[model samples]
Target: MNALVQKSTASLDALKRIHPLMPWFASFVLLLPLPLLALNDYQIYLLNVICIMIILATGLNIVKGFCGQVTVGHVALYAIGAYTSGVLSVKFGVPFWFCLPAAIAVTMLAGALVGIPSFRLEGAYLALATLGFAQSVEIYIRVTNYLGSASGLGGIAPPSIGNFVFYDYFRYYYLVMPFMLIAVYASFAILRSATGRAFMAVREDALSAAATGVNVRRYKLIAFMLSAVYAGLAGSLFAHMVPGYVHPNNFTVIEMVTLLLMVVLGGIGNIWGGIIGAILVTIIADLTRDFYFYQLLMFGLVIVGTVLFMPKGIGGIIDRYFVSKRFVAAREKTAEQKRAEAAAAKSGES
Candidate 1:
């Protein structure tokens, strides 16, 4: 009995020891094939989209998943990023390297601005306001000629590394994957830090978090800005991927909702969950395109099913299943040992 307890304890400790490094290793293994594998243009394009979406989802997860903020306007920040890079690259002839930081900074400021007033409301009200905010941004894009007036900035060029241009989707895939990994790592690092704990605290209970000196407003703004940064970077990468085209209409309220869905489907508050969920959802959405009208309906049903059955998202469901399986096995083993001990005692008594 004592030996079994010690064995179980050791196993738990082992899991704890390896848990930190596991995700990083997994990400590398999953993404490493892009540069090495012989993938076609379509597959590369899909991977590019997946990588970009994962970056966006990870950012959104910071606000919606980690901090528990209901931001349905995340794509507005993406639009800001897309426009910032697009306009600069097309009009000012700014290099992609320079435009990338500008895009992130501009989007981060936009997020901070939106976070200030919109945060006054909570729950469904906040969600509604965010939805409105996204719509407003889209409207502004349509009305402002400086932002291409809905036509969006075109003729954008691929990023050049001193004359070496990334014109193909495969090259774009390699370039974008690094940023995605970095953004994902940063998201997880933030969650593991003291600031991350504060965000989680505020999410779990804002008043209590404030009472504990978490500076809820500051952290909330931080979450929004961080999320914006991710969106901006993803948008910049996305621009380079498309090379010559962009549309303000792409950053609609529906896009924000889709991003939110990715975070939810991935598992709110889990880094890998957000990434995995984004990939699965992206793949499913792409595959369903063959169904035309029924594709969207089916997608909605899948989301509903995930919420109703998985509850915690597919990743969470799988995690729970594994944990439950291991726990049940351990319990059964303990029970068997107890029964064996009891029989041995009874035999001695006889």
Candidate 2:
């Protein structure tokens, strides 16, 4: 087992060294044919949903996992992005391309607002503040006539290039996938930078982070803003997808809870965990569509079970497993080397 793992690791390392971006390029190539393989439009639509959820989960992971901020209002920011883009495209005749950036800017401002409370609050209190913010946004949208209230906004335009419109699931998948890839890649990049280190420092210990001049408040705000960018991009993509529309109910606490479930199940601080969790949850949700009553119950049970048995989440488990394998392999290699050295010494003496 040790030898196998060591060989596998060596192969992976060699591949990575040959071309650092090869894995990413290969993944993109693999995904390109997925729509063709799908049984129907519905499967393609589900794939699109998975891509959107990946963005959302990745963003939530930034705030909750990386920064250790207990926020429950991320869905509201998502809603803000969707509605902003939808309203612009529907009412103002703004193009989808313009709305995308505009929505991101607006959501980033909202994220900054959400982070304001984080400077003074922590844990449940910060969560409550964010929750209140989310509820307020929903309620405001529900009563605002201009924002479409209950009727919701429709007729949002899909993105186009030189007369070619991404109006179908197949076309939109291409549009969304690039953005999702960029978002995930950017996240990895950020987490490796100084800002990312500061965010983790705050997550691990705010007081200690402050003692080390980490600027905890600034990093927290940055985390929220970064996450908001992701949520905003996701919202714009979703709004511009087939059946372009934006509704208040879609951004409610229920949606927030679902997002939280994704982050938690993925492993709070693990990027890969968030991605895996989103994909898994979306697939499971699709499978259990008819069992709506038991869906939430099952999700709740999963969360509890994960917290109790696998606090690090699925990502953590995978990480630990690989680490253990490497450790065992190293031990075996060292023991063999020692045996070889001892035999050589004995032969020399003889």
Candidate 3:
């Protein structure tokens, strides 16, 4: 038993040695200006959509991926952030920068409020409750004339700070990229902290976690709130990127489903998976958008296929094939050595 423990400890130490390099690798890749240098207008537009979707996936992963809670109404909070920023900046004469944080705070509160009820329910019941809440929020937005009702809000201008103007995709790219980086970093930090462990414990077995003095409800609410804040921040980015107007339809059911699919397909609990899954799904969806009628069908097929073949998501498949194989090989070698030692002992006894 002691030998087994020491072997496990040695393996974990090796894993830890690579941990410090992840952030460095992530930063290096993010610094690439390929989008600014090579992409044309159409391609830049596609990249913008994919970047925003990646942000959305990271946010949703906080709730669904890390906390093991399923939330289908994420787009509603996203819409809230977009409209809140849009209305405040466009109609109320607030700066885009100022409205951004306000929207996040309000949406975070709203998420906590919703969690109070939904978190009390488990499994399908929780999902249904969230779905209902999202619909209600959407209906409220549709009926409110302050949001321009059915016609939607428009004429949002590009943001500027001290003579620097954001007038095109290149400028917007820098703007959105920072927010994406911050969100990803924040999610990574959360997953590494005690709160993250609490969430994992709650996810693995709420009753077991509760037995160990983990405040299951509080942590769950925290996860929900954090997730909402992320969605709200994403919404703020979307509003600013478009730099004009938001409509009720802007936050659609399809967007929510897409975010969930990205989270699930990327590998729940795996941060990189969420980022990659978002990009992959967005790229594929955009590729098919030219088809108009067939786009939805294509998206459905991709989701179904991924689930069937890679049910653990793409990240799971990679871990299983690459990481697991190494561990298996190491174990086999250890077993063979033990058998050789037993044979040597028998020969010595003879």
Candidate 4:
């Protein structure tokens, strides 16, 4: 274990020496061949979904994990982004590039509105507020015929450059990959910045954070807005993908619950954990489709077990391993120092 950790540390150091962004570059290079390695088109599609989920889950981690704000309305922002993009592409004849930015802008406004309630509420109260927003968005989409209502909007145009179009799964993978990497990199950057520290301060204790000169309300709003950018991006990508269809059913309570599970299972507030959780959950959910009702039951059991026995989730375990390694090293150092003192005393007496 020590050897592995040392090797990883050395690799990270080497990467840092090369460039601050070398790790991200390496990650992108590693993922570049994934679609080619897939055995089938379906697997390639799954890769796209995983990338989208990573963006969404990482956004959620920013708010819930970093800022300690509980919100269920993230799906509503996601829905808004999807519908915004779909409407622009279908109803207005806008290209995907324009639609994408429009979707993110709208979601950012909605995110601010969602964050308004956080000033006065926390925990379940805040969750309920967000839940209400989520349900409202879902219901609005279901009843509004222009938005396609229950039937859903379709015939959205694929992204293109000149005559080249991202109409196939293979082409679409490239479209999504760079965005996913940027989102992940942005999250890590935020986590290491002054804004991220302010967010953690607010999460740890808002009152104390205020006392320490942190503007709790402002940071909370920033967290929500930043996270909303990711949701909007993911939703827009989904909206303009192959066959281009989005239903209100996709943003239901169950979907929100599943998103939450990604954060929880990955380790809340952990960037890599959120990414890992998104990948695992996407694959697990896909594989369990054959289990029917047993699938949901299994998910429930896993959630319960995770909360009860693994509250910190997989990421936490990874953290503990490194911590334990450091502790062992410190212990050995102390022992060696004590032995040196004893040897010195014995030599002096001789």
Candidate 5:
């Protein structure tokens, strides 16, 4: 098992050495045919949903997993992004291109506001603060007529490149695929960067990080804003897809819980785990659509089970295996060196 992991890791490293982005390039090429390979359009739609969920999960992982911020308001940011894009396209005659960035900008500002409470609050208090923001957003959208409150906002313009329009699920998949890959790629890049290290430091021990000259509040706010970017991008993508629409019901607490399920199931701080969790959970959600009544229970059970049995998540197992392999190899080397010295002493005496 260790040999297999080592060999795979080495191969990936070699691929990186060949070209840093070779793996991503390969992944992109592999994913390009996914829509064609799907059984039907609905499957393609599921694939798109999976991509959106990946962005959402990855964003949550950044704040909750990396920065250790307990936030339940991420869906609200997503709601803001979708609604912002919807309003812009429907009311302002704006293009999807403009709406996309506009949504992100709006959500980014809202994210900063949501993060303010984090400056003084921690744990449950911080969560409550964000939750309040989330509830407010949802309720406001639900009641406001101009925002298409109960009826939902429609007529959202799909993205186009002059003649080509992403009007179908198959075509739309291409639109989201690149962004999803970019989000995942950027996430890994951030994890390897200094800012990511600071976030983790704060996650591990905020006091210690601050003592080491890390600006806890600034990083905390940055983390929230960054997470919001992903959420906003995902929301915009969803809003601009075919049959473009935005609804408040879609951004409720239930959605947040399911999003949380993805992060927790994937393993909080593990990037690949987030991707894996998104794929698995989205597929499962589709398969169990008929059992909607029990969905939350299942999610709850899975989370509790994962936490109890696999706290670090599925990726953690891989991390531990490598650590153990290195430890065992080091011990064997030390033992062999001691045996060599013992043999030399015996020969000299003899």
Candidate 6:
């Protein structure tokens, strides 16, 4: 066992030394040809959906995973972003470039509003509060004539550069991919910084974190706001994607549940886990679309099974495997040193 672990450790170390960024580089390279290799536009469209979900899942992970906040209204914020951008472009004739940043700013303010409840509530109370917020947003949109009420908002323009418009899945994929990569990279960078450590400390024990001079409320708000920025970006992208429409029904409780599932299935707090979860959930949803009657049942079973048998999610399993290997390698090294000392003593005595 020790030998096997030592070999595994050595292999991993060697791989890392060879190229620390190799995995990321390889993934980028592989995905570059996806548009060309795709059999049709549907596949490209699915890929675009996956990219947007990646941003959503990553943002949710920052708050729920890193900062330990329970917020179900994330999708509501997402809807706000979509509508904000859609309205700006449709009503005011704002360019897509300007609408994107404006949507993020608006969503950040909304996110801060959502975080206000976290200061006074927690657990089920917090969840209920956010759920209420989400419902309220949906009702507001549904009843407001300016937002198109039940008919929804339409006529949003696609992003463009001069004469070039991202009107098709192929062009839009290029647009979304860069933003997704940057979001993922930025999340990873933030989680590795001092602020990230404070967020994790609070998650582990808020009282202890407070005692250590961490402002629990501030970090929590920051988490929510940062996550809102991600949702806003994703919303803007979705709003501009093919069809260029935004509807109240698209951002309801059902959508919130789906976001939660992505986080849970991916392993809460695991960055890669959220990405994996998004991709898997999207693909599974597509495959099970034919059996719409049993879709919710199947998703429920999957979540239950994951929680019962692999609570850490897939990322947790990977982490545990590597941890065990390192432990075994350390033990083997210690044993080897003791054996060497013993042999030296025996030789000296002889």
Q: Which ten residues in a row have the lowest lDDT in candidate 1?
A: 34-43
- lDDT by residue for model 4 (161-250), tens: 899999988999999999999999999899999999999999999999999999999999999999999999999999999989999998
lDDT tens per residue, model 5, 252-335: 877888888888888889988888889998999889999999998999899899999999887687668778888998999999
Alpha-carbon shift of residue 64 in model 1 (angstroms) = 0.6
lDDT of 3: 0.80
* Of candidates 6 and 3, the better by lDDT: 6
- Position 313, candidate 2: lDDT: 92
Estimate the TM-score of every prediction.
Answer: 0.86, 0.96, 0.86, 0.96, 0.93, 0.91
What value does the lDDT take at residue 22 in candidate 6?
56
Query: Model 6: residues >4 Å from true position, as ranges?
Result: 1-26, 342-350
Model 4 reaches what TM-score against the true structure? 0.96
Q: Which regions in candidate 5 have their CA more than 4 angstroms from the true location?
A: 1-7, 329-350
Deviation from native of the Cα of residue 299 in model 3, angstroms: 2.7
Better of 3 and 5 by lDDT: 5
Separate clash counts for every candidate: 0, 0, 0, 0, 0, 0
- The models' CA-based lDDT, in order, is 0.83, 0.91, 0.80, 0.93, 0.91, 0.91
lDDT of 2 at 175: 93
Over 4 Å off in model 1, which ranges?
A: 1-26, 35-39, 329-350
* Candidate 1: clashing pairs of residues: none
After TM-score superposition, the amount by which residue 83's alpha carbon in candidate 6 deviates from its true location, in angstroms, is 0.7
TM-score of 6: 0.91
